[model samples]
Target: MAKTQKGDKALHSLFAGATAGAIEAFITYPTEFVKTRSQFGGKKEGPIAIIRETVKTKGFGGLYSGCTALVVGNSVKAGVRFLTYDYFKRKLSDSEGKLSAPRSLLAGLGAGMTEAVIAVTPSETIKTKLIDDAKRPNPQYRGLIHGTVQIVKQEGIAGIYRGLFPVMMRQGANSAVRFTTYATLKQVVQGTARPGQPLPSAITFGIGGIAGLVTVYTTMPLDVVKTRMQSLSARAQYRNSFHCAYRIFTEEGLLKFWAGTTPRLTRLVLSGGIVFTVYENIMKVIGNSGEETS
Candidate 1:
């Protein structure tokens, strides 16, 4: 019975997370596209300029150049993230199901690393490649499948795992900070509510946004490095993650490490809010249904 319940919980998380991820990805992809464009080596153009130029050159659809990859990737990434987080948090918690902040951070770190290795690295690599390829005079990739196939043919399986280490590090820190902040904020907001009771959607959105806001600034540098490392030109320009970071700092200055902050901030804040709002509400409905059937 205990094992059955655990399995059910993991299934619930997977379902809720995937749904949330797909919604968030669809809603915020333009910002993601703009952010990536800004991160590519060029004059520091504003996000608005990038958007206008992309639209003028390739039509509005250009802003969604890699939407399919991101949507699919985020769905799988969020599913794995929530599933592993629940599993690890359960193990780290006490007998009474209470988890401290430190343990929560550890659980999030483990979840992030698991998802980074399994989902994030390859997904991000593909997405970045597609976006970069789209900017060329004669874009090589016609669409997601062709782009993926071309990359694999040119570079083998390693093509899709180009920025594995930096992605793992960025994702590890991202979830660690995000989950911990979200949990802490939720607990604070839930003070008057009964244990295990769900908070209102608005409160979840606010907390999640705040968590994302904090995470973006804290992890922005790593994100920039990850993007640079995963770009099509990375092999020619960068030896590795550290070398990438060093070049950005020494050549481009410290602020260059935060190349796409504005767009990333916009996307992530909305992403965190939308993802948690959707996930929590879905989970609540699932829980209620389970209780009714049980």
Candidate 2:
């Protein structure tokens, strides 16, 4: 019974994360498109300017240039994130016979790092290409499939993994901060609740949202470098994360590295809050069933 209940919780968590990711992708994809374009030095335009230019140049569908990759990437990313984190939480808690904050942190970090390897590389590759192709005279990829296949053929298996190191760094850091902070904050918020009362979804969502904002802002610089590195042509000059970061910093200045952060952070807040709230609620519903069955 206990094992069955655990399996149900895991399945529910995956479903919730995937649903939230899909919804958030549609809601915030334009911001993401703008952020990617700006990050790659395609346009220095603000979000509004970028949106206007994209529509003017590519039509209304322009804003969703990378929607396919975003959906697949985010779904896998969130699914792995929640599933692995939950797995770690259960294992760590059972091993110790208690849930510790550090255990949660480790779980989140491990989950993020793992997903970074499995999902982030190919996803970002497609996304970057789509965003960059938007301004090209003759676009290479008509969609995600074309783009991915082109990369595989032209650059080989290793090509799809471009900017992976920086991705791992950014995502690992982002998840480490996001999950650890969320775990700590959730406990703090729940501590003030009345005896036997559960923490509100709003509280959990709010805490997660704030953590997302902090993590994105803190890691924006690395994200910028990663985007640039990934957008480079297969024959382009730069080699490796260190070289890319150094060149961008030396040539672009410090503030340039943080370009598009405004839109990125805004998207994080709106999307993160909604996704986390929905995810927690879904988890709650599933958890209730598990409790009843137990």
Candidate 3:
């Protein structure tokens, strides 16, 4: 019975994480596209204005540019993160279900590193290429599969992982901070209520929003560097994460690192709220520890 229950919990964590990622990506991907474009430093308008202009100029599909890879990537990444987080957090938890903040942070760190290596690097590469091509006067590689093939044929498998280092850094930090903040918030909010106690979805959602906002801000500079590093074609200019950071700081102005922050913040806050709400609710249905902390 204990073994059966453990199996069920693991399955629930994986499924709930995947479902939450898909739903959140579907809802927020438009803003994600805008965020990416804005980060490239071409757009001067706010997200709303940018959205309107994109719609006006390129039609509705414009907002969904490069969505296929983003959606799939997010699903895999979030699923992996939550699955590993559940596993680690469970191992770190006591019989009373009291997992300390540091333990939670460790769990998050493992989860982040897992998702970054397993899913983020390649998918993000494909997604970034599609979006970057959209901005070019003469776009390369007709679509996702074609683009991927061209990259492989020209640059080999290494091309698909152009900014692997920074991506790992960005995503690793993103999940660690996000999960730590979220778990700490849940611990404080639930306060001796025990693992099964019901907390309002609203509160959980709000806490998730705060976590997402902080994570984005915390990693925004790396995100910018990652974007620049991935958006390039042919030989790369920035050698590594630190070099990319240095050039962006010294050359593009320190403020350049924050260029697309507005859209990113908007997208992340809402998406994070939605992800946690959905994830927790799904965990409730699955009767697993994913929602226990909340």
What is the Cα root-mean-square deviation between model 1 and the actual structure? 2.7
Worst-scoring 10-residue span by lDDT in model 3: 285-294
**Order of models, best lDDT first:** 1, 3, 2
Top-TM-score structure, candidate number: 1
Which lDDT tens digits does candidate 2 get at residues 23-77? 8877888888888888775336777888888899889899899789988898888
lDDT of 3 by residue, 13-77 (tens): 88888889988888888877887777664445677887887788778988887788888988998
- Tell me the RMSD of model 3 versus the true structure: 2.3
* Model 1 TM-score (2 dp): 0.96
Score candidate 2 by TM-score against the native. Answer: 0.90
Q: Clashing residue pairs, candidate 1?
A: none
Candidate 3 Cα errors over 4 Å, as ranges: 41-49, 192-196, 289-294
Q: After TM-score superposition, what is the CA distance of residue 179 in candidate 1 from its true location, in Å?
A: 0.4
